[model samples]
Target: MREIKILAVVVVLTLITYWGVEPFAHSQMHPHVDPANYDFAQADKVSAKEQVDEKKEALEKAEAQAKATGNEKLTHIPKSEYNEAVKFEKTINDFWASNKEALSLTGNATNGATLVQANCTACHSIKKEGFPPVMDDASSAAAYGVVPPDLSTAGKLYSKEYLVGFIKEPTLASKVSHKFVDGRVHPMPSYSWMQPQEIADMVAYLQSIAPDKMTDKEVFQNACQRCHGIKYGDMLGGTMAAHTPETNIKAYMGKVPPDLSQYIRSRGAQYLHEFINDPQKHLESTAMPRVGLTKDSEEKVISYLEKVGDSKKAQREELGPKFLIYLVIFAIFAWLWKASKWRDVH
Candidate 1:
């Protein structure tokens, strides 16, 4: 009997710790529905407010189980899976050093291509004969139903500028890519809006791709075969956009919100940069979360922004300034955003 009671106390305390301790240390939860007037302190808060009732019921079950027996079978309760996610922070930081001289985007195109082959090709294959996999939302690209396009021939299909633009705002592709079809899924999100140097490197890879290496159709099929089809984005177009930040923000996209296809159409690159680093400051209704990109990531991405907004060209065409250009333009803006954040803390 004593053992059962002790176990009960432990179980209860564990639940309390998740509710209290976790919230106090790390969290930035805003009301899932209202983007504006949301709290940033809940970034690490584990309480899934979007499904509050489900969680409450889960806690009750645990409490009941503890009351009845010493063991816990609270299977209904779901906790964060941060442990499973790729630690992009550390990895992206190391990415620069690993490919510094060879296939390095920080320098020139040829170097970046090598890095892309080493890093991106494994997940996304650009050759029909190469055969990577399909986007399936699972291990294979088929998991998301997207077919990765062939980078081998993207150079001929699109220009270097076009490639960079696609990476910056993938949705900008309707105007940028050879494929008129909308091909992407909920899980097959775009990396164009992601870190810039990486985009540059990948663009450089696309630019260097030789058509003699593979056929365009095969390249398209092989490259796109690993991911979901283009309809993925268009299918959920409005609903996903309007969905609560909690549901839409990082749930589908990365920690940041999805505005590249939509927001950038109206707002400029400077706005996008500021919003990327600090979304809450610009739009009170934004559900976006800052990923704390490194200085290099910020600079590289800003440089890539030039390519994304162009309404012309399906292939390589230099659009915006190289990576650092946006950083230089938006440095003051980001600084102001930083000051605002600091002010809020005090």
Candidate 2:
């Protein structure tokens, strides 16, 4: 009876502690917002195709005006005509702001395929099935001192918005230092000249063909494949020479970069974003250069890392309350049994 009373007291105290602290812990861990303050339902209400059509019309009108003025550069166009372009861009931006997910959900893959073949195929390859080199890796290495990374899994690797901004300004995105020598000085040039419609189509095309879902495996392959290796199934993939032959890395970066299979778990998403955006910010004189990934890309990368490191976190969180309830029920049963057994003695 004494032992039963002790167990009951322990159970009650445990329940009290959990109930009292769980809300605070949850609030700290995941802040809640009032849904009434935000119009989440508006996302579904807006038609993606309608928005795209409106954007196309606006671009066409501006292009026609630019052509009449005999101006090859859109920037050289008259202010009155340019304001029309800016107006449409703002409309789309505002629409996307309210419907954040619509941007990725929109775009035409077929048109994007044509645009990609014309502009991107010269450097990037869409084929991801095998480790086949799209361009002459050996020749590129000889010329540039390092081969360019493949874009086969890029759609799965990066978010739509990040890709959009990057395609617009590759130099800004990479954030390379002026001192970086060889071909690094002349990395992929910006395609800011492309029309808004063309950019959207290209982004759509990438997303359409990308893996229906992203995984940590794809994220590592796209971002870290050139410098890191991790075993996948029976084959040992990625660049084995990443660490060894230290002289090769030192020639470019002054140090061999570390493996990042467990980086997200250790460093966290926020840190990873800062590091990717500007490595010099965290560790001055570090060899790692700023990649200039946008906010969307950072989010996608973090999501992939979470899958790799904490796949069961969601399930565990869901079961927590059920487990607590079971413990309470067990305690009650134990208390009842003790009471019945002592009834005659009392």
Candidate 3:
């Protein structure tokens, strides 16, 4: 109860200090590209044809060599011939596959042959140029006739989740999204059977099978941006790194909160070096949580926070002019807003 109350007060003061200041991580960015589409049709044809051909060629060569072995028998031939025949077939298949094409399905498309059998064969057959439709429209796959979207570059076009989601929960996204909203609709009719995580993992593996140019930015924005802002300053108002008065922190916490900035600056970085390495050792009953941070992340966070002071120093030269401009703007806004209807709300 006591600690919670102290925590609540700290949080409240932090919020009050923040007022209307915006966090740094939120970007008013307009995205320039979409990554939720693929072409499974082309992929299926290439994959199926290549696999079937490899298997067929192996079996044929095996049979042919059996006839030539002069044992005059093919069935239970000597182990050497049988093994050689198998090896020859495998080498041929491997060489062909080395150049033919890699699996084109989405990361979640499937693994080895199992995924190939389930998703690839469902809508496509290996063929060149023309093929039966695999997707009738967007919401559903082709009516078992129209060519499935060419899958050769499906893995490359969209993200892993895009492919996996399309497979397990096609309704989430598809060859086309309009059908789900307001176009010629094609419903697959059922998908209550697949586990979400399995599909996600499958997609991850599929996407990784091919090369990718994805920046960590995409992953960060997609996962962490909502809860924690993107940039360092964005975490606690650009002011978080400021030398928040130890008095102020204590005022908020009912105890003399440690002055992180002073500890960082005066002890020649060593104080912070020890404090961050083990805060509990330096200050017992510290309100700071373990944060579950590892040594590396803790080091990185501390190093960056160390910048909180340096960044201020770097910007100090401009503060005078910037402050003047802000004062002018504040005065003008105050004058204008003083007469505005909103000012008299009380």
Provide the lowest-lDDT 10-residue window in model 1: 37-46
State how far residue 220 of model 3 sits from its true place (Å).
Answer: 28
Can you write out model 2's per-residue Cα lDDT over 1-346, one digit (the tens) per residue? 6876786898899998799888788667644322211121232123223334555666676678778987656534344444544554454345335333434456778998888877776666567533355556555444444456666667765656557756765533333433444555544666768766777888887777777655545554566546544322212323223322334444555566665545666776666765665554456446665443434445666665556555666898899999999988997897788789988998
Q: What overall lDDT goes with each candidate model?
A: 0.42, 0.57, 0.40
Ranking by TM-score: 2, 1, 3
lDDT of 1 by residue, 11-89 (tens): 7999889998776654444222222111212321211232344545556667687668866544333222221122322
Residue 165 displacement (Å), model 1: 1.7
lDDT of 3 by residue, 1-346 (tens): 3445775898788886665333322222311221111233332233335445645566567667877885435434344444544554454334333322222432343453354446454564322223343543322211321223433323444544335434543532332221244453433433425554445544554444433432323322222221223233422444232122333434333454333433334543544544433333344335432122223334444455456434465567678889989987986686577558555674
The predictions' CA RMSDs to the true structure, in order, are 21.5, 14.7, 27.4
lDDT of 1: 0.42
How far residue 327's Cα lies from its native spot in candidate 1, in Å, is 71
- Of the two candidates 1 and 3, the one with more favorable lDDT, higher being better, is 1
The TM-score values for the models, in the order shown, are: 0.27, 0.47, 0.23
Worst lDDT 10-window in candidate 2: 35-44
Cα deviation of 321 in candidate 1 (Å)? 54
